[model samples]
Target: MDNSLRALGDRLRQLRARHGLTQEEFAQIAGIGYKFYQDIEGGRKKEIWLSTVERLAAAYGLRAWQLLMPNMPEGSKVARKVASSRVHRR
Candidate 1:
């Protein structure tokens, strides 16, 4: 992992744009604070909670790793493991 929250946030914003969801709408669906998402998008946070990631995954119809590694295609090892881990609630 690059551990670059800003890059991850940028990817998130890009993905949200691709899905045509506004920040408010995506935050509502993802169970996150609009400002928090904005902060994340703004690169203000270096660490993001797992709960937020899980919420985002569920709401975005993706596994945690899909969002975590959003540029990769679906079913990649990271996404698969993330999905599998989520299935087991690990």
Candidate 2:
């Protein structure tokens, strides 16, 4: 499995745990099938669709970019660079 995919799955699991939700509960909240959500959190769904990312982000009241780039510390150089790049894209 790709490192990035594994990291994404790990972050997803952490977020669910932080919210004290089970996979089934999270899946329901995200409007996705339980098995499909499980595949994603298990890192079996290698190529996640943008719609799925948006759904998951919405379920957690987060931005899609935040979900895609998990664990970024606030005020960090890398985070600043990403934020600046996003602003420039607009």
Top candidate when judged by TM-score against the true structure: 2
For candidate 1, write residues 30-84 as lDDT tens digits.
6566777787767877676787677666666667777777374353221211222
Alpha-carbon lDDT, every model:
0.62, 0.67
lDDT of 2 by residue, 1-90 (tens): 888778878878888877788887777666677788788889997677676776676677767788778574232111111111121111
Report RMSD for candidate 1.
Answer: 7.6
Cα miss at 16, model 2 (Å)? Answer: 0.5
Q: What stretches of model 1 exceed 4 Å from their correct place?
A: 1-3, 70-90
TM-score of each: 0.69, 0.74
User: What TM-score does candidate 1 get on C-alpha atoms?
Assistant: 0.69
Off by over 4 Å in 2: 72-90
